[model samples]
Target: MVFAPGEKPGLEQDEVKLQKASKQIVQTAILRALQQVSQESQQRQAPPKGGPSLQLERGKLTKKHEKK
Candidate 1:
């Protein structure tokens, strides 16, 4: 493609602008994904609330039937 001398600079500037915009878009997407993963990991690390507590009793395994 033969571009006129006056149009060459404009085309170059447009190409640079497009490259910068695309880079910014990709960076933003990556940042958002990282943040989401960090949040999910934090949630998983948190302990459950109002759940059954586990304990180890040091005695024989005998079941005492309770009168209900």
Candidate 2:
């Protein structure tokens, strides 16, 4: 689109294609993370009043949250 008369239009087409691809990649990463957290919450039960399993599950949740 920026070309003068007689110049090739290939570079302009490449720029537009690159911009769309970049946006698609970023949005896909965000949605995948959201899906993981929701899935984890569904599979887990409430922690025992107090025990090692409770502590370990809580620690795992914290680590997964930190990863994002």
Candidate 3:
């Protein structure tokens, strides 16, 4: 389709506007996904709080001898 001489620039401007809007939308989606992944990773890496502590002792046990 051939547009009138005056209509060609308008069509180009509309296309440019559409492209800009699409780019903005894609950027927003990527940022949101990245933020969500970061939050999830942080949550997973965090240690649990208020838990019991464990201790290990190294020793040798001696058996008691009983005499009749």
Error of 3 at 36 (Å): 0.4
Candidate 1 residue lDDT tens string, 1-68: 68876776478889999999999999999999999999867755663455532332475544434455
Q: Which ranges of candidate 3 are over 4 A from the true structure?
A: 1-9, 47-68
As for model 2, its CA RMSD to the true structure in angstroms is 8.9
What do the candidate models score in CA lDDT, each in turn? Answer: 0.72, 0.67, 0.71
Q: Report RMSD (Å) for each prediction in the order shown.
A: 12.3, 8.9, 15.7
lDDT of 1: 0.72
The candidate, 1 or 2, that scores higher on TM-score is 1
Candidate 2: residue 22 Cα off by (Å):
0.9
lDDT of 3 by residue, 1-68 (tens): 78886787478889999999999999999999999999867755663455532222366434334344
- What's the TM-score of each model vs. the native? 0.58, 0.51, 0.57
- Candidate 2 lDDT, 1-68, residue by residue in tens: 47788678797788899999999999999999899988767545654443333234644633223222
Runs in model 2 deviating more than 4 A are 1-8, 45-68
